[model samples]
Target: MPVTMPRMGNIHIPFKALFEGLGIDYIMPPPNTQRTMTLGTKHSPEGLCIPFKMTLGNLIEALELGADKLLVPGGYGICRLGYYFKTQAQILQDIGYSFEMIPVGVSERKFLGIMEIVRRLSNNAPWAKIVSSFRFGIAKMNALDNVERKVHRVRPVEAVRGTANRIYARAVAAIDRAPDYRGLKTAVSGSLAELDGVARNEARPMVVGITGEFYVVLEPFSNLDVENELGKLGVEVRRSTFISEWMKFSLFLNPLGINEKKRVQRAAAPYLNRDIGGDGWESVGEKVLHAGKYDGIVHLAPFTCMPEIIAQNIMPHTEEQIPVLTILCDEQLAKPGMLTRLEAFVDLLERKRRVAAGTAKAN
Candidate 1:
C-alpha cells in the first residue's frame, strides 16, 4: 500500500520510522519547495491558511509519483482542522485523482472499528508483532523528538554548520531503510550520537524564542522559512513548543481543561496581557520571560490566525524591554526581503548586546 503524509519541520524522522516499522513502502513528497507551493495554490481553494495550501501541494506531488493511498489525520473539536480530511478527499476526488484515503481520526468506538479493519488488512498478522512494531515506532519517535530539542540549542556556536543536521538526515535515511525494530533502534541511537560536540551559544547572537500554532511553527514555508532565515542572520532561534511537547501537554497538562491558546498564555503569564488576539497572552508572557536572555520574540502566524492575532496585539505591552517582531505570513511572501529584514533585526540586537556588555565591563 502506498502511503502519504503531511510535511512538518524535522518530522520526517519519526514518520519515516513509523511507516518503516509497519513495513509500508511510501514516498515523501519533495521538500516543501517552490514547485510544491505552485501546485498547491493552483488547486487549493482560495482564502485558506498557508498550511492548507502547502499540504494540498504535498498531496499533489505524492499523487503524481504514483502513490495509491493518502494518509491524513481527521481532527476534531471546533478547530477547522477537524474537517480537513473529508474536505481534502472530496477535493482530490473532484480533481480526478482516485486513491484510497486512510484517515486516522475516529472516536473510541470508531478507533476500535478502524483497528479491526487494519488487522484484517494486515492479513491477521500476529498481535504481538503489531504491538512490538508500535513500541519500536514510539521509541524511535521519542529519540527524534529528543534530537530536535537538543539541536535547537545549537546556535551561535562555531562548529561545522550542518554537522548535526547531516547526522540527523543520515539517521532518518537509515531508519527509512531499516527492515525491523532492532535495526530501527540502532539507527536512531546512532543518529543521536551525530549531535555530539554540537556547541551551544558561547558568543551569543540575537536569540529569539519562537512560539506559535503547531502547523505554523512546524511547517517552514508557512512561516516564510523562519528558522533558516533567522539562522542565516547569525541569530540563534529557540522554539518553545514542538510536536512532542504538544503531545505530552495534551496527555498531562491538558487534563486541566486548557486548549492550545490557553496553554501558551499560561506559559507566558509572567509577561503581559493585551486586548490583542488569539494567544496574545502567551506571546506577551514569553517575551517577558526571554527579555534579558534573548534579543526579541517573533510571534509568527498565518495571515488570519486568531490566536496569534491576540498574541501580537498584547506582545508590545509584554515589557518593551525586548522588541517583538510580529510577522504574519501568507503564500505570497518574498523570501529575499524576509532574509534582509532578519539580517537587520539581528544586527540591531547584536549592537545592543555589545553595548550592554561594554557598560557592564566599565562598571
Candidate 2:
C-alpha cells in the first residue's frame, strides 16, 4: 500500500528516509499552501485548531494523489491532538475518499508501538533491517535540527540578508537526498561549515525564547514564520522545541529511566503546577526556566488552543522575570500585522537592553 503522512516542518524528510529504507512505497503530501488552508477550513469545524485543519487538508491531498493508506500521529491526552487522526479520518470519509488510516500512538506506547507499526507497514521486516532503517531516519532528523540551530544563530549576525536562509534551504534538500549514514554525516558537516562561513557582523543581538503549542512552534506556516521574522529584525531566536529532542524524550529517554517531562513539570510548578494538557505546562515551565537568559520571549499559540490560552494568561505574571509577547495564530493572521507586532516588540527589547547596560555601567 502506498502510505501518506502530514507535513510538519522538516519531518517529512526523515519519514521519507525511513519509508524508503523499509522498502515501502510512500507518497509525501504536497507542501502546505494557501490552498491547503482553504480546503481544510472548508471541511473542518469552525472551532477546531489550525493544526487539525492543515493536517486534514494534507490527508485529502494525499488521498487524491492515489495513496491508499494514511499514517497519522496519535495519542490520548487532554490536548485535542490525541483525537486528530480519528476526526480527520471521519472528515475524509465524509468527503468520499476511501483509505486506510493508521494512527501511530507513539505518545502512549513509545518505541514498541512504533516498532509494531513499522512491522505492519513493512510486512514483518527483519529486526536488523528495522533497527538500521530507524537509525538512519533518526540521524537525518538530528542532522536537520543541527543545521537549523546553526541557521538560527547565523541569521541575526549574517552581513547579507537571507544568506543563511538560502543556505539552510539547500542544506535541507541535501540532507533529504542523502542515501546512507556516511552521506548524512557529510551533508551535515558541509552545511554547518557553509553557515559558519557566512559573512557576519560582531554585533550582539538580543536573544528571545520561543515557546508555545508544539505544532505552531515547529511548523513555519502555522506560526507565520515567526522565527524568520525575528531573525530579520536582528534578534536571535532560541526555540524551545525540536523534533529530534521530542523524539528522544518521547521514544528513547522515557524508557531508559530518564524523565525530561517531570523535569519540565518541576520547572513549571511555581506557575502552572499541573499538566493542563498539550504543552501548557511546558510553555509555562520554559518561561520560568529561561527567565533571565533570554532578553524577551515570543509565545506563539494557535487560535482557540486551550493549553496555550492558559499559558498566555499565566505568562504575564512572569513579566518581572522576563518580558513576553504573545501572538495568536489562525487563518485570519496576516504577515503584515505579525511583522508590525514583531517590530514593536524588538524595539521594546532593544530599549530595555540599553537601559540595563547603562545602569550596570553606573554601578
Candidate 3:
C-alpha cells in the first residue's frame, strides 16, 4: 500500500483524489494521535512545531504498516516547512525504511509537475491519462473545499442544537469516504443541500471570526469544537484559512507564499510590533478585519501559543467596534460549558447590535 502522509488539515484532497483515480491502493495514517506524537518527538529535530513532529511520526507509522511509498510535499520558502521535507526524508532513510518518497512542488514547480511524477511512479498510466486524472481529482477537491468553506462561514449563526453542524459533519464524513471523482463531487455538493432551508435573517446571531495557529484553527478537537457550538447558538463564523486559500498559497508562493511567521507578524502588527511566531500574522489581521465585518473576534489557541496570545491581546485594540473573545484550550476544556459561553456571547452581541441600530435611528 502507498503510505500517504497526513496533511496539515483538509488540504490533501487533491493528491488523495489523484491516488484513487489511478487505482493506487493507499492507506492513510490515522489522524495524529498520542502514539503519533511519541514517534514524532522521538525522531524529529527539536524546536519544530508539535504538528510537524506528529506528521513525521504519522509517516513512520504508515511505513510500519508496509506501505511501499510515502507521499510528501516540498515547499519552496518561508516557514521552516520548506526544509522539513528533505530532513524528514533523511530521517526516514536513517531509520532503514526502503520506501519510495514522492515530493510534490519542488523548487516552485507547477503542481502539474508533481502529478506527472506521481503518475509515472505510482502507476504506468499514460501521460494523457495521468493529466486527465489529476484534473478530475482537482475538480472534486475544489467542490469539497467549497462546501467546507460554506459550513465554516455559517457556523456562528444560532440554530437548533446540532442541526447544521450535524449535516456538515456528515458531509465531512462523506468527503472522507469518497472513493472516486464522482463520489467526491457528490459528497462536496451534497453538504450544501442540507442548508437549503436556512434563512440568513431568521436568526441575527453574532459573527465571530476565528484566527490563530493553523492547526488550532483547522482541527476541531484542538479547538474544542468551537465552530459546532457557535453554530448551534446562532453565531455566524468565519475562519482565516481554508483549503482554497492553501491552494492559492501553493500555486503563487508569494503574497500567497508559505510564510507563516511573516504572515502572523503582519496580521498582529496592528496589535503588536513584529512577527512573533511562524505563519501567524496574516491570520491575525484576517481575524480582526473579519470580526469587524461581522460582530466579534474569537481567537482559538493552544495553551502557551505565544504568537497567537500576542495577537489575541492586540485584537481588542482594533478600531472595529466589535467584541473580542480569546479562548485558550488544551486537553482539559469542558464541552457543554464552552457551548453555553458561546451561546451567551452571541446573545450579548445580538443585543448590542440591535441597541446600536436603534440609537442610530433615533439620532
List the candidates' TM-scores in order: 0.79, 0.97, 0.74
Candidate with the greatest lDDT versus the true structure: 2
Per-residue lDDT, model 2, residue 28, is 95
lDDT of 2 at 86: 87
- Give the CA lDDT, 0 to 100, for residue 228 in model 3: 70
Clashing pairs in 2: none
Per-candidate clash tally: 10, 0, 23
Weakest 10 consecutive residues of candidate 1 by summed lDDT: 271-280
* lDDT for each candidate structure: 0.67, 0.90, 0.67
Of candidates 3 and 1, the better by TM-score = 1
Off by over 4 Å in 1: 24-27, 106-127, 159-164, 178-194, 198-202, 251-263, 268-285, 319-321, 358-363
What tens-digit string does per-residue lDDT give for candidate 2 at 197-264?
Answer: 99999889989999999888999998889999999999999999999989988787655676666777
In candidate 2, stretches whose alpha carbon ends up further than 4 angstroms from where it belongs are 254-260
User: Per-residue lDDT for 216-325 in model 3, tens only?
Assistant: 67766556668777766666677766655655555445563466434645655666565554445665676544554778777776555566666676666676557767
Q: Could you tell me which 10 consecutive residues in candidate 3 have the lowest summed lDDT?
A: 256-265
In TM-score terms, candidate 2 sits at 0.97
Q: After superposition, how far is residue 57 of candidate 3 from its true place, in Å?
A: 4.2
What is the C-alpha local distance difference test score of candidate 3? 0.67
